[model samples]
Structures are given as C-alpha cells and as structure tokens.
Target: MKKLPVNCPSCEKSLVVSQLSCSNCETVISGSYSLPILLQLSSEDQDFIFEFILSSGSLKKIAIKLGKSYPTVRNKLDDIIERISQLQKS
Candidate 1:
C-alpha cells in the first residue's frame, strides 16, 4: 500500500491526523488535531534533534560527528531544548 502524504510541502512540517473514515459504512469522524510544536521548527532543527538522539545526548560526540565546534554544538542543543519546552507546553 502506498503511504499518504503526511507533511506540509512548503515547510516540510508534519500534518496532524484528526479524522478517520469507515469505508464500509461511509461514516466519517473528525476532530481537532494540533501539530506538535517541534514540527514548527526548521528542518535544521529537526536534524539536530535526530543527531542528538542518535549520539545519546553526548555533546562531544555530536560536535565531532557534525564537524562543528563544541560551542556550536552546545548552542544548537540549547536551541533544541527551548523548542522541546515550547512543544511540551503546546
């Protein structure tokens, strides 16, 4: 089966699913669905998050793998943290 498009094209953001349909009965259900705040972040931020997770939250390793200075890695991490907090609140 083909997967449906699940992200915004222009911003590359994820789309929240809030509706379901019953094929046999032709019944449809809908509700409010909010996209996670993290999806509002830039693609770079998302990549940083993935890398951070893969590196097991090790700043030194992340910095080296990303070929960025330690301070840069730290700064990126800080930005990601702020985003996460905002996401949690929303």
Candidate 2:
C-alpha cells in the first residue's frame, strides 16, 4: 500500500483532506475534512509542541532536553499556542 502524500510538491503547500475512501468497498465520503490544525505547523514547531507536552508544560525541562535557551523554548511554545488558538477559532 502506498502512503498518501500530505504536502504538495510544486509549492510545498499543505494538503487538506477532502474525502476518505474505503479500499475494500470502494465507498467514498466527501465533505469538509480539515487536517488537524497542528499538522499545518512547521516541523520545528511540531517538535517543540510535542516536547512541551511530553515535558508536562515545563519550560525549564523542555529547554534542557532540547539543548536550547529557556527564552527560545518559551518563544516557540508561545508561537505554537497562538497557532493552535487561531486554528480553533477558524
């Protein structure tokens, strides 16, 4: 089985899913199926978000684990939070 391509090659644009098909039955359902808002984020932001969650929202721990400055980790977390909030609103 081939994995579905999640990003556009030409422009590197994010691809949103519009439908899901059942391979066995050949049944298709189509509607507004948006990708989880987090999927739209950059890889770095996603990693930061994952670490933030795994670290139980501790900035100090996240900074140490990521080998980054506390301020840098905090800034990335803030950015991801803002993006998540925006996605929720939209």
Candidate 3:
C-alpha cells in the first residue's frame, strides 16, 4: 500500500486528514484532523523508529544493522527525538 502524504505538494505545508471511510460498511466520515506527531515525520524516519523498536531500543544493534557507527546512530536518534519534541509543542 502507498503511504499517505503528510504535506501539500505545491505549498509544502502540512496536510490534514479530511476524510475517512469504512471498508466493510461503506460508511464515510469527513473532517479536518491533524496527523499525529510521529506520522508527520518523513517515511525514512518512521522506518528508523520501527527498526529501533525492533532492535529492543539498542543503539549498537541499530548501528550494526545500518552499517553505521554507534555515535552516528545515536545522533540520528537524538535528532528524531528533538524533532518529535518540537512537533509536540506546535
């Protein structure tokens, strides 16, 4: 399945979920809803988070899996944490 876009193509602004539907009942609902902070991240970052979880939050394991230095992986995770914090405050 294709991932849902979190930003507008032209304006480069955040996008909201305006409509949703039930596949089973064909029921539909519409409203303006902001994407969750985590979902607002780029797909690559989301995948990193997934990997981090899968590795049991081990930076060394993640670094090894990505073939990167442990400090590099740690820095990347730190950056993601900061981004999430900023997103939460907005």
Candidate 4:
C-alpha cells in the first residue's frame, strides 16, 4: 500500500485528518483532527526513526545496519532529534 502523505505537496503545509472509515463496517466519521508529533515528520525522518527503533536505539547498530559511517549516523540522529524537538515545541 502507498503511504499516506502527512503534508500538502503544493503549500508544504501539514495536513489534517478530516475523515476516517472502517472497511469492516463501512462506518465513516468526519472531523478536524490533529496528528501526533511523530506522524507529522517527513517520510525520510519516519524511516530513520523506525530503523533507530529496530536497532534498539543504538547509533552503532544503526550505522552498521545502514552501512553508513558512525559519525554520519550520529549526525543524522542529532538532526532528527532537533527536528522532533522543534515540532513538539510548536
């Protein structure tokens, strides 16, 4: 399945979840709703986070898994941390 976008492509604005449906019941609900902070991140950031979790939050393991240098992995992690912090602050 294709990933759902968390932001608008044109305006580069965050998108709201306005409607939801249950495939099993065909029940639909509509309302203005906000996404969690993590879900608001770009897809690349989300993949990095998923890998970090799969690596048990170890930079060394992440570096090895991604075949990147340790410093590079660390830097990426640092950037992700700052981005997440900024997102949460808003």
Please name the candidate that would achieve the greatest TM-score relative to the true structure: 3
Distance from true position, residue 37, model 4, in Å?
1.2
Q: What is the lDDT for 8 in model 2?
A: 84
Show the lowest summed lDDT stretch of 10 residues, model 1: 1-10
Question: Which tens-of-lDDT digit does each residue in 12-79 have in candidate 3?
Answer: 88899999999999999999989999999989899999999999999999999999999999999999
- TM-score for every candidate vs. truth? 0.60, 0.66, 0.93, 0.90
List the pairs of residues colliding in candidate 3: none
In model 1, which regions exceed 4 Å deviation? 1-29, 87-90
Q: What is the lDDT of residue 41 in candidate 2?
A: 73
What is candidate 4's lDDT per residue for 1-90, written digit by digit as tens? 598788889997888999999999999999999888888887888999999999899989989989999999999988989988998887
Off by over 4 Å in 3: none
What's the alpha carbon RMSD for model 1?
5.5
Q: Alpha carbon lDDT of residue 12, candidate 2?
A: 71
Q: Please give the lDDT score for candidate 4.
A: 0.90
Residue 16, candidate 4: alpha-carbon lDDT? 91
Q: Write the per-residue lDDT of candidate 1 for residues 1-90, one digit (tens) a residue.
A: 444554778896567768979999999999867666666666778778889889998989999998999999999888778877876875
Model 1: pairs clashing at backbone N, Cα or C within 3 Å: none
Please list the C-alpha lDDT of all candidates, in the order they appear.
0.80, 0.81, 0.94, 0.90
CA shift at 84, candidate 3, in angstroms? 0.8
Q: Comparing 1 and 2 by TM-score, which wins? A: 2
TM-score: the better of candidates 2 and 3: 3
For residues 1-80, could you state the per-residue lDDT of candidate 2 as single tens digits? Answer: 45456578889766888889999999999986767777777676877778878999899998899898999888887888
> Against the true structure, whose lDDT is highest?
3
lDDT winner, 1 or 4: 4
